[model samples]
Target: METATIHDERTEEGRRLTLHGRLTVRVIEDISPRLREMEDDPVPLTLDLGGMKRVDTTGAWVLYRLVEHRTEQGFITELTGLTPRIEALMAQVGKANQMTTIRHPIRKRHFHLLARIGAWVEGGIYQFGTFLAFLGLTMLALVRALMHPRRLRWLAILRQAEVVGVSALGIVGLMSFLVGIVIAQQGAVQLRQFGAEVFVINLVGRITFRELGVLMTAIMVAGRSGSAFAAQIGSMKLAEEVDAMRTIGMPPIEVLVIPRLIATTIAMPLLAFYGAIMAIVGGTLISWLQLGIPPAIFILRLQEVVPLTDVLVGLIKAPVFGIIIAVTGCFHGMQVEGSAEAVGEKTTAAVVQSIFLVIVLDAFFAIFFTALGWA
Candidate 1:
């Protein structure tokens, strides 16, 4: 390898620096300080690359930096070169350096906060619109299925009912039963202070039938069946099966969404009722064992104090909760993009959105029933 050399000469026009030999990585560090000195000179600079030499990207970067430094200082800099390849190499290096030197404007903190809030509001509105559109489409599909009973997928509905309802019974039953025991135990503790421990039956019966049974059942279904719906449909979407159905002139809503919706709607009320019964049984057992309130007396008090309206309140909300969970899950499933990661993401989102919406809907129902003097 030839040694890299930099020879400076004083000329009438300016100070001329001639680069010679192989200007590669080996010599760039040694030559950089001299280049920086030349940049600081008040006189105009001319870089002469006509000398016999070899050059690579590292050497080209050094030369590019020298020119850029002089240009930035308002000094006239000239490059006299011969080879097309070196010129092209230097041009690319120059462009890359220019790109690196460019700085983006810093955003004001208050303005950025406002922009973020605006974006959040925009996203919320967009999601609301998407949900409303999905609801409308589902209603239309239901109407079409109603007009043509043969179009209804009975087998799929049964399969989904088993998946969403029958399969979930044990977990729902256990959760509600445990919740009832806790409520009864806590109510007994509190009521004993007022010497009214027997009223724990009223508290347990009213709360389990009117609120907790249906709410807990809906939340469990959202986490279990809602996520399952999203995962199943999302995987089909990723496989292009949903698109293939569309190409074959089958509406995905009719074939997929309606069955799940119908199955969930039928299943929720039954599950809620079952959950309520198990919860009452659990409370009765706790009352008997812990409070020394006999099973017979507890049952008699429950029947007399807990009205039919209390049970009806929760049952009425069950189908509505079912619809919300089903629609949210199916909507998010269809929105999944073409990837396994997207399917997973949409499945998680479906569960979260369904559960959140169920809670919100439950609150609204509570307020509405209270307004009607039913609570």
Candidate 2:
């Protein structure tokens, strides 16, 4: 036999309904009048469906519609007498009021922020470790090169020099010229206040010969040529070309990197010299126009104020920066993972870390020169 019970209780101003046993569609139709009776009251609707044994989807749908009707009328539906499992099932089927019960959105946001910071710190550590590893390898390569000078391939070195050095000329020249013009204009304004506009030539010459020429050239190389080296090596790594070289019993350091290192070291100093010349030309032109210093006076002042040692110092930093750049590029290249995204990321890290190391090294040189009464 099938049996069901519907009980009603009266509060101070409202009625509560308790339903037991299976709530079929027919039972809901029979209880429509009782539901209508409670609809007139301003109190919340309480549906005690605790004894519900087996609810069909139709019963679940009916309960959802009742909850929606209560919500539209600004009355809350309190579902009491439900087992935890039934309550969970109701929530899962979208028949229960589960929307406003979520906890702690701020904690979720805080965790998200922490995750981002952790990722950034991890990346920083990896890049710093890569820089250190490259530094060690470069020192090793340098020792090997010195020990086996005959093994250094001159043809490969010259080819790399032609590629990295010769190809960099146009961009370096343009950058140097623009830098010189800006410096001259600034010096002209400052010197004019002191009735020393002619000294703009000395200002441009000393600044360029001392720092700007070498530093700008290094930065450009880091961006342009260093990125190229890293990307090329990274691509080779992805294609397993580096592995093929290894399989063929070729020393990657000797055949690939050593040649590049030698070429860039030789070429960087020469580029520094050319860059200094372009800067002087640009500064001279700017001084002629703004400071009223003729090309002859500019040349004489430049010769007088610019020590030959300043040019030597500028050129001296180039090879060191070049080695740093190349080694960093190769290290990050070799660290490339299997994915294209990883290759690109490591290549970018190489250039950024190279530029950072160059500036840091330059700062050390600046301090060293100042201590020696050179700057």
* RMSD after CA superposition, every candidate: 7.9, 10.7
In model 1, what lDDT does residue 117 have?
100
Please provide, for model 2 over 27-121, each residue's C-alpha lDDT reduced to its tens digit, 9 standing for 90 to 100: 66665555556554567667888877766555666566666677778885687887765656556667444567666556677899999999999
Least accurate stretch of 10 residues (summed lDDT) in model 1?
94-103
lDDT of 1 by residue, 41-157 (tens): 779888888883788898888778878787888989998874887888889997776434668989999999999999999998999899999999999999999999999989999
Q: After superposition, how far is residue 92 of candidate 2 from its true place, in Å?
A: 27
lDDT for every model?
A: 0.91, 0.80
**Superposed model 2: Cα runs more than 4 Å off:** 1-119
Clashing pairs in 1: none
So what's the TM-score on candidate 2?
0.68
CA lDDT of 175 in candidate 2? 95
